[model samples]
Target: MPTPDFVLALREHVGHDLLWMPGVTAFVLDADRQHMLAVRRADTGAWTPVTGIIDPGEEPASAAVREVAEEAGVDCAPLRLVDVRTHPPLTFPNGDHAQFLDLCFVCEHTGGEPYPADGENTEARWFPLEDPPPMNDRFLAQLQIVLADRPEARFRR
Candidate 1:
């Protein structure tokens, strides 16, 4: 299957000049703490947390807020930094090669209903913590770390 335009652009940029750096991922929780907001990637069908690449001039916290709004159409106030992770350098299917340092924050949803804001995501829904959507082991591990009372954990460099 052909890669999506965004992926293609990412690959091209990374393959040539741009270098991907630290990014932020958000695990947004509802007021009742019964649900967590997640987004389904259109390209990979992976039900993952809301995340985005931190722009050059942007702070990681601000990036987290922006990404949550962009990917999940929700306003959130990040409660605290939860976990920091690093993905090994690898070439994406679209041919982009780069390493990612992910800063995962746990945030509380402040406003707006969950919905896909744009091309970044296809579906946004509140998932019960007890019966979360299918996700990779890495993501599950990160979620566990965030839910734990510890300050933060680092993994997979």
Candidate 2:
């Protein structure tokens, strides 16, 4: 579902209030690690990694994998947690506000061609890792961290 049932239920009590949520960004790399999956968001038309809110009681890594499949029409396995950071708070056009604790994961593409499977995105495809399409500063920063392949996940201080 686009909006989770839990979030809808909570909205009944807190209309338009900022809701702190846990989210996932899945950087899905092909088996050979030469390319990464990206999706053009339907709302913003910006290219980004597969992103979604983690369901209540769901593991972040599992959410990453699930998001890749949901948004990009591909199966993947989380290779590692790459970053943990708080996203800037924003209000939706509908007046709902939310801030996210983002868990970014590097996932290995297990199978299937990439396409925008969900209405949330318009286009989904693989891009060369060395030269991905342009992204906003926030996403580019996370991309750089993933490319560095550090031993530990980056935690914003």
Candidate 1: segments with Cα more than 4 A from true spot: 1-20, 152-157
Candidate 2 residue lDDT tens string, 78-149: 989999999899988889999999999999999999999989999999999999978998889999998999
Candidate 1: the clashing residue pairs are: none
TM values, all candidates: 0.84, 0.96
Number of the top-ranking candidate, with lDDT as the measure: 2
| Global Cα lDDT for candidate 1 | 0.80
Local accuracy of candidate 1 as per-residue lDDT tens digits, 94-120: 545667788988889999999988886
Q: How many backbone clashes does candidate 1 have?
A: 0
In terms of TM-score, which candidate is strongest? Answer: 2
* Candidate 2 local Cα displacement, residue 67, angstroms: 0.8
* Overall lDDT per candidate, in order of appearance: 0.80, 0.91
Model 2: per-residue Cα lDDT at residue 115:
93
Tell me how many residue pairs clash in candidate 2. Answer: 0
